[model samples]
Target: MSDGPRLPGVEREADEDRIVCHVDADCFYASCERLREPELREEPLVVGMGYEEGETIGAVATASYEAREFGVESAQAISTALERLPRRAAFEDGTLDDPDLEREDTGYYRPVDMDYYESVAADVREILHDCAGVVREVSIDEAYLDVTERTAWEVADGFARHIRDRIRREVGVTVSVGVAPTMSAAKIASDFDKPDGLTVVEPGNVREFLAPLEVDLLHGVGPVTARELREMGLETAGDVAAADPEPLVERFGERGRELYDRARGEDDRRIEPKGDPKSFSRESAFAEPVEEPDPKYDLIETLADAVADRARREGALYRTIGVKAVTPPYDVNTRERSLPGPIDDRDLVDRIARDLFAEFEREPVRKLGVRVANLEFATADQTSLAGWESAVESDPEPDSESEPETGSERESGAEPGLESDPDPDPDSEPDPASGDRLVGQTSLADFS
Candidate 1:
């Protein structure tokens, strides 16, 4: 009944269970920069914030292990990083800083040019598409592959190695991959060694692999959630696994059940593909916020093209257009417009996307996105707008102007037309620097 492979290194099973692999590009942003310039391969590199080297307001986008040696880390504010490493001046040269640009107090900081990174991410995704049977992209740097048909874990490691080498040679980035019986388990494994680590978690070893890790390592647990779990004396995945579900439910509500399932390595979530992503969005956070229209428009054009490509690949069409703009510190803004009906017109998507983007006008934006909301599978019966079923019962307009939904929610976790609910914000920008998880409220099958 199970599609899991029968091979060594994979968990022994008596029943149906799926073999899933989670592939995550290591130090995605920093790695992408290294690809652009081969010389920085082993150098101490940190990508985050704006050009200023000493400012901590902006978080670390990614730090090469070399940088990590000096305590530089992703998500840690850049200002705080200066205390650990020397500072360096920025290069607006539209090129990697000259090796000579180094300074004592100002360590090296690379401004995030998502346009370059997005292109590299696409190449990596292409490698995954070639290797996977059922591929589901989780982020620009992360994805889930169902390799059940083509390979087994005994050989999965080799597959991962080949993919890794290809990504490095062809895509110019290294990735860490984890293979396991379930998606959650594989995700945890992928993060184990990091920066080109290859970890495989067998089904039988799932519990063993997860037991010693802190509760926060579980997919859904965050700082706040972990803190609350700790108050109940639950520190490790094992602790949470052993706790009574009712009490957890009483304390954290729905999240409690989710925690319990993850603790027990019971994730039933599938590698559901978004038949075609209605919208593809990429946001670049800068230390110094940007309000310039020309520059922002350029970036929007780049992102719009990528989204169009994804829609084309998935055979999906869109009619609604939207965008999200985040102003420094923590202000999230969003806007959306609906089309006449489902249409696969990329130029139209681009034109409408840009039109919607005009609203941002000159607003300072630390992050920005482009979205096509009224989605319909391109392969579906082509019909006029009046004949199609709506994704939601209400109007197709985005329920509210908020940050894009989280990646998870965008695929199938968020409830349509119910943006204010507890569902995860799927469209929100994913922090490659930080493994931030956002799940929308919807069924996986809906998107697939």
Candidate 2:
């Protein structure tokens, strides 16, 4: 007889399939300002630290959507921002030469305040922790949650909305949430309809949803990578997904493989808490040292299966598979092999474990242990400059009035916040208005 199907809980879902939630606080720094100064709500507000009440010497830390409408943007020099969105104070105090500048034409400006922002972020973090079992806290303004165990595909939209609403009600800050089967898609989905938006990308529709997105929209595709992709005739994610991988690998190395996988919405990385154990193992003490290889091999298979199962249950991907042998007279020996990347293949685990144990197959064995190490857990972060909550007073809803932007419709889709790779020159500040996707810029939290 052959085994066909197993019952629920008998076999865990595939490692690639998961319900990942990406929560990103919209215009986080600017939103924190409105939380305390309610008067700033509905007004074009710019919070640029070091730019004093009447000075224009500092960089624009963040600009509200209202300010953005007037050509104001994050990282723009305050002097330039002032030229576009003249200060409301200047209009009120009649300091401008042109009396045509009405109060409505000007915007309020405030210095960046970090202490207050962090307290607000703390409240928001509390609610995210409660919604999912596994959360990777990426930064002060964004995080990734593995909600596979907490929810099903049928009602994932409601689950995501619930999170958005809870944060709005409790913390007084609006957040955009994206739900998808993979982390990369979830991150992109979260940004799909920003500013208190909620979008869910079902497993079946992941490919279709990602197909229309620009390569720049994909996570970790910085300006440099994007330029390279475009040069290779891969403008959108669909193009990259359909293109041959050999050239990509030749160009970007391992990252090329990663980029191709993400474009196809195939991220296998699981959301796991930081500081998790590096390895897991299963071992059994032999009643007596047996000289037979048949008995020793059987025990090795059992131990390998057990160790692999434990890692899977814990949502871990191990790159190294190892085995231990305790021979007669308690002499211990060990062997292991490391792979290029993390994986959750049980058969590979067994095969590798068995191969490693072959050296001791002929010797008498007292104890055998199977081990897996070099665990990889999902860790990820987000975009800033999204406006604060759209509807803070009443129940917030997705931006139903506005249509979500298709991949082609989005202008840049470059990540607005930190960069994926650390800057080689930490002290080298980026150009204030460089249009490229930048990293290591000053953040409100950094001020704190």
Candidate 3:
């Protein structure tokens, strides 16, 4: 029920500069699931594996902030989580699954349908491009937009609000937007609110706004780093800014200086559209050491689903599929197999992933990972454009019966009437914003 901040006019600037904004979909997987089935919106929804009441085989993928309020969090053991939140029965009874309802914890599992998640993520990406003048998608649920060319902050906030509404209306999800003078500031601002919230931080006010924030909130300050910073009496970002640099450097080396700059609201990273990556991986760690292979195979299938879904979502085809197993702290193993041609097939991915998992049959794996590597981000037509020309110019008349069908003929065809336009880059700039209203964007492509 939180309404975001209003747009403000620019006051002044030291020099001409571009404006950036970071937009992050809140509890993305949970939100996506909510969009898929609206009934779960008001419930304490959790998305993860090993929902078979008290099972330790699965980890949580995402939990709504509402769920988080009850101590549910990502990567936590599902068995322990049910003890904190009320257990809701699964859909087998045609009733909503709330973890707090049942005590015995029978059938507490919620399966991850990566195919459905990918479809929704793709739709979200489309919505992002529409709102951006320059969009740099950092992950499935987050993106940075440079809106300097077409609009400024005063007007762009309205645009962001409209996007938020449109996504809820058409896509059935909520997103948080953070606006600041720099990418670092903006990234932090977006997290200020939960689902469906927006916050704006102007350039001149960056230091004042960041001063009271926890040192852990700084971009690169992890829990370990935050603990160290606390030991140095640097509890808040402002403390880090005020601390002597010499002492910090003595303790943490070059990273210490980097932390100092970040704490002072100084990060200068740009949003660049890097296309599909060369590999995709999904991994899961058990709450306890897992020695059995059955649970390991189950996790591998889940990872396979994630890998295939990623390839299709990014319009990427992969030549190699691989698996990684971490037995504990020291032992790590990986294996891969190349394919005859680049493919986006889920069955084929599972086949290769499972084949690689066979190597670790005797190993006690605590964590299992599946990856699709050597990715190429071109449509079949784009990759084979030259081949098309060669067929047209063949000396003997090409087989008229062998003509390729139009894209629309495919079962999962592009939307109607929009087929003529090429798919815009997922990460494009936003509509222009005035200099003062511009916030920041995140450059990291991998999802945290």
TM-score, structure 3 vs. true: 0.58
How many backbone clashes can be found in candidate 2? 2
Every candidate's lDDT? 0.63, 0.68, 0.61
Clashing pairs in 2: 27-386, 419-439
lDDT leaderboard ranking: 2, 1, 3
Least lDDT summed over 10 consecutive residues: which range in candidate 1? 407-416
How do the residues 1-448 of candidate 2 rate in per-residue lDDT, one tens digit apiece?
1122222443344553578998887887678777656788989988774445565356776788888999987767777788898888878887777857777889988765544454455456546655777666655677788877666677779889999998887566788999998888898899899888999999888889988898887877867788889999999999999999999999988888988988988887767665565666666656777887898889888978877776776677776777767664434466777665567777777877787778678888766777788776653211111221222214322211112111100113322332221111122335545532222332222110
Arranged by TM-score, best first: 2, 1, 3
lDDT score for residue 2 of model 1? 28
**What TM-score does structure 2 among the candidates reach?**
0.61
Q: Higher TM-score: candidate 1 or 3?
A: 1
For this target, which candidate reaches the highest TM-score against the unseen true structure? 2
> Which parts of model 2 have CA positions greater than 4 angstroms off?
1-16, 53-56, 276-429, 432-448
Task: Judging by TM-score, tell me the better candidate of 1 and 2.
Answer: 2
Looking at model 1, residue 124 earns an lDDT score of 64
- Candidate 3: stretches off by over 4 Å: 1-14, 90-109, 276-448
